[model samples]
Target: MTDRIEKIVRDRVGEEPVCLFAYDLDRLAEHVRAVVDSLPARCRMFYAMKANSADPLLRALAPLVAGFEVASGGELDKARAVDAEAPVIFGGPAKTLAEIERALRRDVTRLHAESALELHRISEAATRLGRTVEVLLRVNLAGPFPSATLAMAGRPTQFGISEQDLPAAVAAARSLPGLRLTGFHLHSLSNNLSAEAHLELLAHYGRTVAGWEREFGLRCEVVNVGGGIGVNYADLDAQFDWASFSRGLPAVLDEFPAGVREVDFECGRYLVAACGVYAAEVLDVKRNHGVDYALVRGGTHQFRLPSSWQHSHPFTVLEVDEWTAPVPRPELREASVTVVGELCTPKDVLAREVPVERLRVGDVLVFHHAGAYGWEISHHDFLSHPHPEHVFHADAS
Candidate 1:
């Protein structure tokens, strides 16, 4: 935890239990700026709003990213609310006709159609609105993908058009009126960590698109490689090789067919995950069935990434020497403690059997790498638990 966050916890913790999310906007801006600046020519970074859609984070990212990638009508509205004139791309597996009409009305830069039926829907909506819309068909390539935390494609997932159906999708896109087939979107995996493997995947996409252009006699312009860049929750020190990725991207992009103009990346977690922390106060410390457990005031309802990913989240024990209660304070020293939250289900655990030096009842457990997909993906209303406060920190100028 940073000193600012520690100070916030100290000032906020009282008789009531403290559970909140702290965001460092300054750090976010600097990191995003670096990522944007490092990109090679023909590559643009689009912020995937589904990861962390907070107003402040969106505002911070508006000026840095090339545009916003929204997966729903609500996300598109949120993105437009922040910057009406900014470039926006709409992508999702299940898009309603209302959403299609909304995207056409909103003047989104591109619509990523997931299937041939979706292409028909986009064409229908565009024809009704009397507007010509640019579209990219999202393809689920048949692949032996690398090992990652999650895989969105290379299987029978309800994500994108199957590889065998791409030719039909392309034909439909060409035949559909009021629609311009600009490019293809091939986002296969999620939470991919290796830069070399990602580069290899990009090369594969380039090759596949080139073959499609040859076979279908089409001109592909934009390739949206949907963001799956990952954060190492188990080891904070080790992270995705962004520097190597950026340095290597130029050569990888050079391999694309000559007609390909723009390569877009819609990243969410990798952009903002490091700039936030989740802090929860320890409510009780006890041993059950010969296993130590540190029960916290907050649980998976507040931050579900750990439980959802089924990984032991990394955290630090912030010692707070304050005891206002009359009863004795429970302390666990020099042992592995499983951290749990105030939820009814047994699956409300955050970290299991984590080694800690000294953890007391009042000390705050700060979970790192939580800026994106922390509260945004959590089930906040479960069990009617109070929501964690959102605290944004701007650098002291």
Candidate 2:
């Protein structure tokens, strides 16, 4: 930990209790640049704004990233507000015609058409606007991706058009005067930390793109291997093999007739996860049924991962007392306890069976690796507890 963090923790421990989410934009921008730089020459990187739509973070990443992938009009507004010149790719399972019109008016780089109905709608909208719309047909590749196992695998997922419909869809797109089918989009299951799985997905999509190019006599300009790069929440020092991911792209590109137009990667979690920390102060500590539990003011209402995904965040207790030397306090003791939040439900757990250095009431606890999906994905106005305050570190220099 640095002196800045130590001072922030100490100050929070001394002041009135509140949860503060610290964001390190500089470190996050570096990560984004590294991934984009390592890709092939024609590759374009887009930041998935759904991960963390904080204006400050977006402003920091706007200059570093190539484009923004937006799922809704609200996200589009956010991207435009920060990086108006950055290219935008509009994608989602179900989009209103109004939203499609908004995207068309904004001249998004590409609209990922999810279904036949969406294609028709987009074509009509473009025709009304008297302009051609570039689109990527989102294909549902039948494969075993981790996202499939958790949310999309066995369930009826409404993410992309089926593989079986590709032929007809392409033919239909060709007939639509205002719509041009530029490429194919496939977003498989993500949040699984398996590089092999991503490689397999890339290979499958690559072959599919190759086949489409040959059959349609049209070069696939954009091959979007959708985002799902996992973050190192458990161990920040653990290495993520970007080399393995880069190695697989060349073969996928080789199949493109136009010699692989552009590879677009929509990344979210991998870029922002490590740069966020959620700081909360302990409110109460109790022993129940021979197990110790520390209840904090913030709960699932604030951070929903622990209860929803059974995920555990790395936590460190910060003691406010002054010390003459930089040494561990001998008076402090270690204890195994469950860190929970003040929620009405029994499932309001932040960290389960966690070991901390003798937590006490009013002591501040910092949860690490909370940059992505922490506050963006799930937030219920349930308990009326105010949302977590967001703080940005402007100088990660």
Candidate 3:
């Protein structure tokens, strides 16, 4: 871990007093390339820009990925700015007519129609533009995921069309002249690491697509199995089982007919989570109610995962003096204390009951695995704190 941190510090020698997110562009590109290379000939990868929309990160991934899956018009613009050649696939519940028109004008590869109403809207937009729009019907597969962080794919989730509503939605889609249903889309939930869960999802989707093809007399040209590859934050030694994931998928694909159909994966967190680290500086230390507190300059405003996800980050102290270790500070000797940020909110606690060697001003506190939705989703300009800075690193190749 120290070796990795040292490599990042060495790469950014001239940069000053700025929050650095240790992003290994080469490693990120290699991860994408590996996935693309190993996947079957029909497989296609679309990077979900909602995970991290930093231009540098997108630019690094643009050359390696097949396309971009955007949830909003802003993300579409970011994808276009980075790589215009990469096809864009729009997916969201609240897509406006303007956004649909923009997607039609840009000639996106595919649009994921979420609802029956959205299907009609797309048809209307396509008629106005006088062009046929290719689309995939997003299906909701009812199942249990490991993480209970959110109610995804269940009742009250605004993600995709339910299995029962598929017939009516398909009928509506078929009624439109300019809309062509190309495939099916299904995303189970987030933070699911079990290979069995993934295999089950694929198997269910495969059979469902086969049934849809037979009923509608339309061959399914594409099957997009959404991505939720979990990251190992608590145990960095544990690596994700890509082999099991790849091996389990073929059985499901075998259910489909012997035709050239594209297998698409919209991956966001898995590609970017391991590649980023959030660095902050300690501002002050004090005692309150017989407990010592470490007040860091940075807070939930800069890194929002602690508050947003109701989770704790793996925190480490950096750039400490070896000689100062012998004479422990009063704060360090006291009982475990909460690490608060400069934010005004009482809930701005970064970590509670964190045992540290010493808490002092100018000490750097590092948060691991913060690359995914860390600064990308958590940042706000409130309280006048500057936005977090990003640093990109490339190997010597």
Candidate 4:
């Protein structure tokens, strides 16, 4: 945890437990700016808003990113709310008619049509709005893809158009009126760890798309290689080799067919995962049947990534010495502990068997690498627990 966040936790005087998500906006902006700066020419970075759509984060990213990639109508509205004029790309497996109309009305930069039927939907909506909409067909390649934390295309996932159905989808995109086929969206894996592997995948996509352009006699302007860059949750020190990846981009672009003008990356987790922390006050510490557990005021309802991914989320215990309780203060020292939340369910766990030096009542469990998919994917209203306060910190000039 940063000193700014520690100060925020230390300065609190209330008897009630403190649970909040603290975002370092300055850090976020600096990280994103560096990522953007490292990209080669003709490569665009679009912020995938589904990861973390907080207003402050969006505002921080608006100028740095080429545009926003919204997966739903709600995300589209939020993206527009943050920056009225920023370019927006709508994408999702199941897009409603209302969403299609709204995207046309909102003047989105492109709509990534997931299926042939979706292409028709966009055509109908765009025609009704008297607007010509640009589109990219999202393909679920028939790939024995590189191993990753999650696979979106290799298996029978309801994510994108199957590889066999590409011909039909392309036919629909071309035949449908009020639609311009810009390129393809080939996002195969999720939480991919290797830069070299990602570069290899990009090269494969370029080769595949080039073949398609030749076979179909089509020209693609923007080939959006959907972002699956992974964050190192287990080892924060060892992260995705982005510097190497950026250096390798020119070679990948060189391999692309001349007509493919630009490559778009819709990254979400890699951009903002390291810029926030989930800090929750420890309510109690106890040993249950030979196992130690530290119960906190908050749980999976506020931050669900650890539980959803079933990983021991890395965290530090911030000792709070101010124990004004009249009774004995419960404490755990030099033990491997499972950190749990106030949720009634047995599955409300964050860290399991995490070794800690000294943890006491009122000490804060600071979860790192929580900026992306933390609160955004959580079920907040479960058990009617009060929402964690969102605390954003920025260094003053």
Candidate 5:
């Protein structure tokens, strides 16, 4: 955290004290630029808005990415307002017919058909619209990923069509009018930390797509390798090796079959997670049952990532020198303080028994890498707690 960001937080706090969310757009732009610049010529980048669709974030990434991949009608509209002519790819496990109609009416690049029924719906919508529709069959591969915090494929889930049923599905899609099977979308993992393992998956996708094209004789133009580039929250020092992956991708692309022309990436968390910091004020500090605890003004309702995954959210203590309380401040030196929120549940804890040099009642705990799923996914209405201030910094180091 820089002095300028701290000042920005102070400014946002104003007279009445409350939790604050600081988003560094400058850092966001820098990271996105690095990722886009390192890409191979045949590859394309799409910002998965489901990660963080905050206006500032979308606007910052609008010019950098090839387009936006949307899951809802609202997000599609939000994407166009930011970038009027950016191509959009619509994909979801469950999509309403109205949503499909909306996507077809607009200038969508491709609708990733998640099921045979969805494929029929897209065909029906396109036929009704009197326009041909481009689509990529989202296949749920049946295997384990080399290394991942969460795996979406390899099992029967509500995500995509199973690999065993692809031959029949592809044939059915081909037979449908107003539908073109342009490629396949394989989003197999979430929070994948190994670059080598990711490369292996990419190669597997290329080989799999090639075999399908030969067996089904479909013209595959784009192989959409959905992104799960990880953020190493546990070991902050370790990060996904983008540079090495970028260098190795060209060779993998060379292994693709004759019909494959382009590769698409739909990246979400890795793009925006590092730019946000969620700051909350410590309401009180006390030792309960021989264990140290600090209660904050906010709870899982405001920031749910820690509670959702049941992980000790990494945070840094921002010391506060001002305390107007009449009672003496609760002082602790080198203590393991388990930070709990205002919610009345055991699951409201953020960081559990984390070491801190000095944490008082008025100090702030700033959770790092909260830019993606922190506020957007949290339950804001619980307990009717006041929302945190969103403070954006253009030039925070």
Candidate 6:
């Protein structure tokens, strides 16, 4: 893992617990190309810009993806600034009129209405702007599937319109002036591990949309499956099966009724997660009661993915044996350690009970699968800790 990211961190940053993120642009491009080339031409790929709106990252992905899926005005601006021509889709549960107006004025390609009222707001915004706007109804499925780590479907969530309210919402959207229901947004999974489950979810979406078309005589162009593609931080071996998924889409599309020309996968984590790694300097190593703990200079304030997801994040110890300290620090040969941050609470744990060959004070730990939610979603202002440094690496190719 360090082979791909270590030198960039070590050379650019020294001992300060710099929450560094390094991207292999070439690998990222290759992965995006593979996903794009493998999938059917009818399927459109959009990067969920919320994952990591880093300018360089956005610029790199713009050429590869069909568009950018943005939830807020800032994301919309970032997406447009990086690549002015790339289509952007604006959607969220609660969108202020200002946001709606901005999206309309900026000429966003689509607006995904999460609630009935939002449709009216979009209509009003578009009407006031005197422009036609396309919209997709974000549907929250009302049942269960192979379980996900975090669920956005099969329950009462603030994400989308429940199936029961779909008819009224559809009527409302259709009746609203300046609005066109061109598609449906069925995004439920949050960091899903199973490709089978993801495909199953997609199949369910296709079938449900087909049923909608049959029952309500609705015609749509795209089904935006908002990004929740999981990154396996616990075990590197286990990953979302992109190959099988790309292979299975044709059959899945067969389930949908005719007229749906485009299927958009707003993938954020799957595309960018592997490209980043977060490193922090170890300040102390000791035993807390019966548990071994390695305290770092930074805590969840820098990288909150582990705590937010309630999973033991995976990491590697980059032995920074160049200890210039006058006092001798305790060093371990081969032992299990729970790496904690410098936070006041115990909840700052990053990786719990992980096996490491050597860990000592001054050594740095590099957390993998951190590209998605590391800096963007973390509570960096918790203790006024310095924010992580951003580094974009070009492929040697």
Every model's TM-score: 0.98, 0.91, 0.90, 0.98, 0.97, 0.96
Ranking by lDDT: 1, 4, 5, 6, 2, 3
Candidate 6, superposed: residue stretches over 4 Å from native: 2-4, 12-19
Tens digits of per-residue lDDT, candidate 6, 265-384, equal 898888988878888878888997888899987778888888998888888888875766689888766789999998889899998999889888878888887888888888889978
List model 1 lDDT by residue over 100-174, tens digit each.
Answer: 999999999999999888988999999999999999999988988887888888988999999888888888999
Error of 6 at 151 (Å): 1.2
lDDT of 1 at 128: 95
lDDT of 3: 0.76
Tens-digit lDDT string for candidate 2 (219-310): 77677878867765566667457778787767656655566678788988778877788888777788889778888878878777666677
Off by over 4 Å in 4: none
Clashing pairs in 6: none
lDDT of each: 0.91, 0.77, 0.76, 0.91, 0.86, 0.84
Give the residue spans of candidate 3 off by over 4 A.
1-18, 144-148, 322-337
Which residue ranges in model 2 land beyond 4 Å of their true spot? 1-3, 146-155, 255-258, 322-333
Deviation of model 6 at 175, angstroms: 1.5
Better of 5 and 6 by lDDT: 5
Candidate 1's C-alpha lDDT? Answer: 0.91
Q: Alpha-carbon error at 142 in model 4, in Å?
A: 1.1
The 10-residue segment with the lowest total lDDT in model 4 = 7-16
lDDT of candidate 3 over 288-368, digit per residue (tens): 777677777678888887788766667777754322343444335534757788888888877778776665655677887
